[model samples]
Target chain A: MSTERGLFDLTCADFGLIRGITESWDHLLSRSIAAVREQFIEQCGLIAQAEALPRIAGRILGLMVFDGKDYSFSEIAEELQISRGSVSSSVSLLTAMGVIERTAKPGDRQDYFRLSEDPYTTFFARARNRAERAHKTIQETRDAVPKDKREIRSRLKEYETFYATLIKALDSGT
Target chain B: MSTERGLFDLTCADFGLIRGITESWDHLLSRSIAAVREQFIEQCGLIAQAEALPRIAGRILGLMVFDGKDYSFSEIAEELQISRGSVSSSVSLLTAMGVIERTAKPGDRQDYFRLSEDPYTTFFARARNRAERAHKTIQETRDAVPKDKREIRSRLKEYETFYATLIKALDSGT
Candidate 1:
């Protein structure tokens, strides 16, 4: 009976050891995931800055894209470690640009936000619109030039062509 | 003989009056040209700022595109009314981007510059390159995720698609 009891105790001990190891492994995996999330968010901010956008806006986008979940205004601020004011402004800007949309959750009074259904298309469309406006401006400038000045008129034509091509490319892509 | 001499003097006076009128008209026309050039350059600067590029760089491009003539470094500085140092840096940036090229004028040591051959294509190509790099980054981020994280992976895939479409459109247009 004594021998049997000892064997049982040893088995329990081994199980405890195994459980501890498994728990630690789970903890490490979660930590690694968190680290990757942080790094990815930072990278998004950097990329946005490279494109001359506000880094905070990019980070907000990163969180939405990576987590694949909606976040409340305060949640975004807390997750990004930014001020609520900045969050308000950035959220407004993103919404205005049609890159993100607001949502309502059951039993929640505050608004939540998520990436729009087709933000990429909206973004490209905006780019195309800007290019069209630029093309119009160039055309007007060209028209203002006297017809006798062939050289200047031709040069302006090149600018018009550049904007036209850009707009067409954006239109087709979107 | 006296009457004939008086008539000859009157004719000379009329010629002087007509020459003065022509000179003033030329002055006004040149001023209008200068104003249009200034407005165009300013527009270029604004457009550059919109794209997150330096205004001076855009102005330089505007000058080159509008004038359709090569300009010396000092001439660019003088014409734009910017500091020589600014012109130097902006010129370097433009050259590096392949939008402008330097040339040597015979019997003159100073370097002259003009728009690159097909600068529009080069500009679009650079944009496409940026989109490709962004797509690659998104792909790398997606790969880092474990296979089980299907949702995150799919979100990143959308980003990849956006860049791919943009690149393809740019390629087709250019």
Candidate 2:
């Protein structure tokens, strides 16, 4: 009976050690994951700001794009540390921009949002269109100016040419 | 004698009319040119803000790129309607970023600023490097996470793949 008691004690000690190891592993893993998510959100903010999108909207879209998963409105707001109302409006705006879309989960009343199939392609296409229009506007202005305003006319021509080159570059693709 | 005087008066009146038309044309041309410059500056501000650049610096760079000429510090300040101190710091920052360079004109004491030889190419190259670093960081995190966390690991993998595709796309030119 004494020998049996010793075996039982050893078994309990080993199990507790294993549990401790697992718990520590989980803690470290969660910390690292949080860091990655934070970094990703920041990157998305930078790109979105560059593209002239609002910060919160960019963050929501960024989270969806990187995670590639559908999120409920509350989930996104909580994850991003933003107000629920802000998330609601930003998601709506992103949906309208074709950067993200809403889907309903079966048997669940909460709406879910996910990135569009090809957000970057759509964004770049819009940028190309804007450049083309700017080029046309510059061309018209150049034509309207008199010949003697050589310096100003030359500047407009350069802009027209640069935009033309840029559009051509964009069209060629990678 | 009377006929000669009348003819002279008619000639003078015609000459004055021609001068007035020329001056009016010049006035309209300058105003339109100013408008174009203002619009271009505004566009640059938008793109710069999107890219996390200082707005004034972006405007100055945009002016140089479109005009394809060097400008003195005062000229840039005056043209953009910004303070000289802002222009000074913005130009310095842009020069450090490799988007613009300082040039000296023969016989002119003041420094001039102009766009770098290929600003867009340089800018895209920097962007590619940043993407590569992000991919590596994500890869490390993905490896560190436990296999049971399939959702988190999968998100990191997707990000890795997307950045790889983006760098490839950026590398393919323009």
Candidate 3:
């Protein structure tokens, strides 16, 4: 009977801790949101860098994707603590790439930016195009090389095959 | 008959152009390979930057992936035009991360480095681990917040769902 009472007290203490954490969750996140935001920025920065663009473009995309809401240029700049000019250029680049879309509010001249419905699909589509181009380049190089150079022929053929397979996989969406 | 002759002439011209290009393909790539190499380096550099690692590590991996062959430290330095020390440090980091592997020649003391057979698989595996960690963080944050704040609750829930779905996708390898 004493052991059962002790166990009940422990369970109640655990519940109290849970209740305290649940009540203050927002306060905790608000205090630590900077770290989370930085991590997302880094993730997007990587994607942007791989695509051979400025980090700012990735940061803007990351912000838009995470917020899951549209933001005007001024709003984005203010939220991200960046300059309006930087936001303008990055937003323009992302718009041209079709990674983000531009919309406007009724009776408002401000342009708002948001991520596309399926950004990953669009992202991989661009990658597939790049792979296709590289594959074509390798094929051309293979054709141009002398038939006698078997080693070079074999190496180029391998590259050609890799790119071909990459494009096929991307096209298949698997 | 005249139209047939004109078509034949056009085909012959095209073949002639192909022959010329074929003969010069090796020469062309040799000159342009630098640009191509830089592109790979840039791509890898982005990945490294996002991961908060040195750019050299990505450059080494990029070179190995593109070359599709094992290379000695000196050869890597020579090909990528980086310092020997940079190669040593970056190669170590990549090796530790399992992104690159170290091999050896039977009669040679020098260590050779090459990319893993399926680098993308391995790369995404690491990313999935990071995502799982982030998901846990988000879950904890959500648990700590008050339930009465609908806007904050919805936003946190959205982020939690995104990370949860991401981890699941990565786990399923689809």
Residues B1-174, model 2: lDDT tens digits:
354654346676788998999878765565465665666667777666655678887688668855778899889888889898998899998888888899999999999988776665665666567667767766766776668878777766765776677666566655
Predicted candidate 2 versus true structure: per-residue lDDT over A1-174, tens digit per residue? 354654346676788998899888765665566666677677767656655678888788668855778899889988989998898889998888787888999999998988777655555566577767767766766776668878768766765776676666556553
Q: Model 2 - which docking category?
A: incorrect
True contacts kept of 2: 0.21
- TM-scores for all predictions: 0.81, 0.66, 0.56
Q: Write candidate 3's Cα lDDT for A98-132 as tens digits.
A: 87899988998999888765554554566567667
RMSD of 2: 9.9
Candidates 1 and 2 compared by TM-score, better number: 1
Model 1 Cα lDDT, one tens digit per residue, A23-81: 78764454466777888898888877766678988898889899989899899988999
lDDT ranking of the models: 1, 2, 3
**For each prediction, how big is the interface RMSD?**
3.3, 4.7, 6.8
Whole-model lDDT values for every prediction: 0.85, 0.73, 0.68
**Residue pairs in candidate 3 whose N, alpha carbon or C atoms collide under 3 angstroms:** A25-B144, A25-B145, A26-B145, A144-B22
The regions of model 1 sitting more than 4 angstroms off are: A1-31, B1-31
Flag regions of model 2 displaced more than 4 Å. A1-47, A62-69, A106-108, A126-141, A144-158, A168-174, B1-34, B65-69, B106-108, B126-141, B147-155
Error of 2 at A74 (Å): 2.3
Ten contiguous residues with the weakest lDDT in model 3 chain B:
B165-174
